[model samples]
Target: MDQGGAPPVFSVTAEGDDDRVHVAVTGEVDMATADTMFQTALREPTRALTLDLRAVTFFDSAAIHAVVRLSQRFPATLTVLPSAQVRRVLEVSGLGEQDWLAGR
Candidate 1:
């Protein structure tokens, strides 16, 4: 569900079973909303997790940090579908080549 202000600058939704969960994130992901994104994505237990950030508009260092921490939790099971905004940061942060990133 969306958890943000009036216009809802951020929203996160998760679906799938315990074996495979898909989390779709939309809107901006900055310092204020990064932790919420991380926590919401992990609200469900799963052996495999996919984070879809294609709709994110503003991705910052805090968001990248959150993604990294989330990946660490899932490691071999984590997959990230990053948007242009997120990809840019990942590339500059030297994490764009991570195995967890899809559609590289």
Candidate 2:
């Protein structure tokens, strides 16, 4: 679901099962939508969680922060699938290659 935000915010689709939860995100992600993403991503209970950012067109520091926070909270359960552009930002933010970002 796309949580309404200021402008150019992102949409999130969350799918969950017995062992895992998957969230696919599209559009831009920034301060306007970071909290929404965080809330939506953590709304379910699962042994594993995957964040799919393949369709994201823009990612900023706030998006990076959201990923970091989720990683911290979920520990071994969180995974992030970032696009090339988002991967670059994650790398610059010192998180792209982290094991915590490994996707299922």
Best by lDDT: 1
lDDT scores for all predictions? 0.90, 0.83
Write one digit per residue (lDDT tens) for candidate 2, span 1-104. 66565444569989989688998998888999878888888888777889998888899999888998988877888888888788888888887678876541
What lDDT does candidate 1 reach at residue 87? 92
Q: Deviation in angstroms for 34 in model 2? A: 1.1
Backbone clash total, candidate 1: 0
Any idea what lDDT model 2 has? 0.83
User: Where's the lowest-lDDT run of ten residues in candidate 1?
Assistant: 1-10
Candidate 1 lDDT by residue in tens digits, 1-104: 65454555788989999798899999999999999989988898889899999999889999999999998999899999999988998999999999999988
Give all TM-scores, in the order shown. Answer: 0.90, 0.84
